[model samples]
Target: MPTPIKLSSRNDYESFLEKFDTFLLDCDGVLWHGNTLLPGVREVLALLRQKGKRLIFVTNNSAKSRASYSLKFKKLNIEVNENEIFCSAYIAAYYLKNILKFPKEKKIYVIGESGITEELDLEGIRSCGSSEDDDGKDFDFNDIHPDPTVGAVLCGLDTRINYKKIAKAFNYLYSNPDCLFLLTNDDSTIPYNGTLYPGTGSLVAPLIKSLNRNPDAVMGKPNKPMMDCITNEFQLDVERTCMIGDRLNTDIQFGINGKLKTLLVLTGISKEHDILIKNAPIVPDYYLPSLGDFSELCK
Candidate 1:
């Protein structure tokens, strides 16, 4: 087996960053906490740009589309184009179209937020609800029947989900085990304005719990699909790409799994002492107090 790679000092991390050409960044915690941008984050981004390093924002949140994120980035004073942002929504669409090889016009049953439906549309996949009748009008429950052509069951963040929808999705999944069970991302909760709101993972977890079925696939950070998409879309060299984030589980694990350098900034979710815990599976290639510290390291 190959020896595990580790970095224990700031010097070691700076040396690694000096050689890297591409930077894969995590958005939520690393760049901003909810709507609040972390201190000195802008400077770090500017410095990276000045040094001619390619930067790509990789996020696991699929509740919103790329266009939504692009607008959010602009509001946050981050200059990111559409191509620079990659979310789980994009990966989910890619997997459904390419990996599963679903037919161009196949109908899908989606139990997700609006973003999930939008992503399916982008791939030219048709989504039908259980209530649709022959004429495409909403049908009563007595007349509702599972559409045999349903290609897959896609679960995302559905704030308006009810028992009826959940039951329908569960029945479809149980009857069609061969059909794909795709999740946008596995985020348990999202931090917003200092409060925790249920994320897609919370919504999907119940279905998994009720059916006792693991997802056939989850296309997000710490997964191979997102990493592959980054490489293919940006033409970045994996060995030279560094992942910088504020979380240990997702961000650090993504770098470790992808064999790229990982930097953990303490300005967000995970703290410095957390890594010192006895059984922590996550350890970053570098540890900084915040993105501000990274600015100094580059100089």
Candidate 2:
């Protein structure tokens, strides 16, 4: 039962800052809640920049593309480069394009929002079944004429998920064993504006149940695919990098599994009690009340 050191004092902040040359930060809970900026986040980020620390925003939110996320940063008046963000949507696209080398003649059936499709477009990959397919039309077994050209089914956080989309996606996988199944992420719940809502994992439950199969790859936090992509892209030295987030399952576990330093912040899905529980399955190397704690150092 190893206890996590609480980062509170200025000395603690100094030591922590000096320990890592790169910081991988989770967006929703650690930096902001929905559109609202968390307390002292800007100051802390500025301080890190001043110290010449490399910052990377890593998020499992597949509902937005990197360009869309960049807009959110601008809305908050935060100066962030598009390259500094690595999102699940982008990872999925990258996987299809570079790793998977998806056939040019084939198309992807997207069970998600524009985020997934937008990234796919950037990769010069064709896709369908996103916002355009989310019409209020009821599902009809007869309407499902499975497209053999649909080489893959990519699932993400689809707020507009309906029976039609699910039925179509299921049919694609069922009819074509070769049709690859991919998930942008599997976060069960997402923190938004201080409330927990069903995430991408929840959306894919029906598909998983009906298909009786897991995705071939889940390109998000705590997954090796996403981590490998990041490592290759940045050439990161895992030992000198720290992962900071508010969730134990995805964020902290991502860091721990990758052999990187993990820092848990008590501002999102995971609370202090989670780590304090007896025989906790996962724990971070350090815990802090918030990323904003560095505000004092910034002062």
The candidate that achieves the highest TM-score relative to the unseen native structure? 2
The 0-to-1 C-alpha lDDT of every candidate, in the order given, reads 0.76, 0.92
lDDT of 2 at 249: 90
Clashes of each: 0, 0
- Residue range 93-172, candidate 2, lDDT tens digits: 99999899999999999988888899999999999999877788766789888799999999999889888898899999
Per-prediction TM-score to the true structure, in the order listed: 0.86, 0.98
The digit string of per-residue lDDT tens for model 1 on 1-299 reads 22224444667556766879999888887888878888778887887888788989899887777888889988988878888888888778877787777886567777766666777789887886523312333434665456557768877766666666676777777777766677877778776776678887788887799889888888887878888777767776777888988777778898889888778877677877788666667887666676666666555
